[model samples]
Target: MRKYWFKVEGLMFKERPFCYLKFRHFIMIVVLGCFLLTNGELSSVIEIEARIPQKNDLFSNGKMDSYDSLENRKLLLFIIDFNDFMCLSCLDSFLDFYYCLPSDFQKHLSWGILVFNISEKEGNNNISARIVEKKLRGFVAANNIKFPILIDKFHVFNGLAEEGTVVMVFDWNRKMVKRYVFPLNKGQIEEIFKFLTE
Candidate 1:
C-alpha cells in the first residue's frame, strides 16, 4: 500500500491507495439508499388495497347482501365514517359526480357506500344496531341515495386501509386499482371515469 500525503489549510492527511474508490463507493451507497427510501414511500402510497369483507352480514337497504354481488363489474366504493362532517361532505360531492354522469357511462359502474366506525364501541358512544339503522335510513332517504348503503356492523372492512373517508376503485376482477382519500378532484374523477369506461 502507498501513502499519499495531502495538505489542506496547513493540516496534513494521508490517503490510502484506494481512497478515491472508497469515496466513490460511499457516494454510490448514499445514492442507492436514497433511491430505496423514495421507492418504498411511493409504493406505500400507490399500492394501498382494500380488504373486502366476505361475510353475509353486510346489510344494504334493509336486506342482507354479500360482497359477491359486487363481483364481475367495475365497482366504486366509498368507505366512510358517517359521523365525520368531512366524510359526509365528501360523500355529497361524490354523489353529485355520480348523478351527473351520462346514462351510458353510469351503467358501466356499480357504486356502494360502506358505513364503518359507528357500531364499534368508542369511549361513551356504544351505538346499537337499531339506532345505526335508523340514522342510516334517514340519511339515505334525505339524500335519495339509490345505490346500496352497506352497514358494516362487524367492523369487517375497518383497519384494512387508513381510517376516515376513502374511495376505492375495483376492476371486474375485484382488484383494487386505485384509491383516493377524501374528496374527489376533477383529475381523479376523470381517471376513475376512464378506468370504468375501459
Candidate 2:
C-alpha cells in the first residue's frame, strides 16, 4: 500500500499502486551494476593469448617462442603448481593423454605446460631464481616432456589457482572453448579429444 516516486529530469513520476517501486529500483541497480562490470555485455566464452617470454625456455637453448605465429593451431594449455608435491598426478595425466593421441590429431593441436611456484619458499628450500630455474629444467629433462615447459613468469593465471592444476582449451581463433580443473581423468581426456575433432 506504499506509494513510491522517482525524479527524472526535474520531473517526479509516481509508481503504480500495485508495484513495489523501491524493490524495482534496487533490482534495476543490481542489473545495471552487473552490466557495467562486464563492460555492458557478457559472454560464455573468453579469448586468452598468453605472453611467452623470449628467453624463458628451459630447453631449446633458453629461447621461448610465441604461439601467436601459428594462426590455425588449437592450444591445450596445462597449468600446474610446481610447489605442490601431490600435483604430479596432473603431469602424469598430461603425458598419458599426449602419447595416446593420434598423429593426425597431434598435428592439428599444440600442447604446453606452464608450471608456477607461487610460494616464496619452494619445497623446503629458500632458493634463488637461478637455482629454481635449474630445478625446473631438470624436471623437464627427467620427464622427457616433448612439449614446451615454461615457468609462469607473469602470473597470468594466478586467479585460476595458486595451488592446483588447471587445463584450458583454446581454439584456432584463440577463443577459449573449455577449462578443466585437476585431477583430470580419462573421461575428460576423451572429452577434449572429442572437442578437438569437432
Candidate 3:
C-alpha cells in the first residue's frame, strides 16, 4: 500500500494512493445499501404447488350473490384480487399490466377481485352488501374491468393487505407458480408472461 500526504490550512493529512477511487467505491456501496434498505421486501418469482380456493359464487357480471352453486373446473390463470380500494397505486399497477395483456392471451384466463377494505359509500363508511355490489358494478363498468370482483370476507387465501396488492399466477391444476406484489417490475411481468404462455 502507498500513502500520499497533503497539507490544507497548515495541517497535514495522509490519504491512500487511490483515495478518489476508494471514495467513489464507498459512495456506490452506500447508495446501493440505502436503496435496498428503503425499498422493503419485494416478492420474487417462486415455484410452489397449492390448491385453488374452493369458495365460489362470490361474484358474477358485476353482482354479489350468495355462495350459490359453482361448477369446479381446471383453471389456467387466475388472479386473486386482494386489492384495497384505497391503495390506488397498487390497483393502477395491476390495471396497467392487465390491460396491456394480449387480447387472445386475456381470453384464456379467469379473473377475480377481492376487496379487503370495502368503502362503498363516501367518508370511508361501510355500506350494505347491495350497495357494495352496485358500487362494484359501477367501478367495473366505469373502468371497463372485465372480471369478477370478489369480496375477501371469507378471507380466502391472499398475500396482500391494505398497503399493496398481490398478483398471483396459478397453473391449471391450481398450483401457485408465482406471487408478486405491486407495483410489479419488468422482470416480474416477464416471468408471468412466460408462465402464462407456457
Candidate 4:
C-alpha cells in the first residue's frame, strides 16, 4: 500500500507540470498574435480605416498607396474620405481637425489629410488622379488648410470603397485605434490630437 501511494503521487507531479507548461504556451501564442495585429488596420461591423499612411510611405513624393499604409502601432489613422470636397459640413470638419493638430507632429510620424477620389469614368484614366490632385489643391488653397492633402486613388488600381469621409487611426503596425461615424466635436478632436501627437 505504501509503494502504490508513492507511485501515484510521482505520476501526478509529472502530469501536472506538463499541463501547466502547455497552458502557458497556449497563452503566449494568443498574446503574440494580438501584439502582431496591433499595428495594422482592422475592420469592425461597419467601416474600414487606417492612419494617414505617411510614415510607411517613406518616399514622401505624394504618391497614393492604400496598401503601403502607415505602420503606427499606437497612432490612429484619420482617413477622411470626402466624396465631395465641396460639401460645406465636410470642409468644416476637415478644417476643424486640421487646425487642431499639433504643429510639431511631423517629427514623429507621417501625416496628411488624405483626399481620395472614387469616380465612374472607369478604365485606367489617370486623368481622375490628376483631377483629384488639382481639386484637392484647390480645396486646400480655398480653405487655407495648414495640413497637407494626399490623393489616395488606389481605388483605380484595386477598386472603390464606400462614399463619405472615413477617418481611421492605426498604431505602429497599422492596427486601428478608433473611428468616428459622426463628425467629431472640438473636444473629441482635441483629445485625439493630444494623444496622437504627444
Q: What TM-score against the true fold does each predicted structure earn? A: 0.50, 0.49, 0.47, 0.47
lDDT of each: 0.56, 0.55, 0.52, 0.52
Regions of candidate 2 where Cα sits further than 4 Å from its true position: 1-72, 85-90, 103-108, 111-113, 118-128, 173-176
lDDT tens digits, residue span 94-188, model 3: 77887877653343244554544444554443344345455556556666765444554434434444345666565543345566777789998
- Residue 71, candidate 1: how far off, in angstroms? 10
Against the correct fold, how does model 2 do in TM-score? 0.49
Worst 10 residues of 2 by lDDT: 41-50
> Global CA lDDT of candidate 3, please?
0.52
Off by over 4 Å in 3: 1-83, 104-108, 118-131, 158-163, 172-176
Candidate 1 lDDT, tens digit per residue, 1-198? 123233441232134536666777999989988996765221111112233433432334545456686565566676656554334664676667767665533332334444545433453333554555666676666765555556565565666435556767778564667787666788988887787766
For residue 175, what is the lDDT in candidate 3?
44
Candidate 4 per-residue lDDT, tens place, 24-102, comes to 7999988877875775222111111223545444335555445445333343334555565657676576566656555
Ranking by lDDT: 1, 2, 4, 3
Position 161, candidate 4: lDDT = 25
**TM-score ranking, high to low:** 1, 2, 3, 4
Return whichever of 1 and 3 wins on TM-score.
Answer: 1
Segments in model 4 whose C-alpha atoms lie over 4 Å from true places: 1-76, 106-110, 113-124, 156-163, 171-176
Error of 2 at 124 (Å): 14
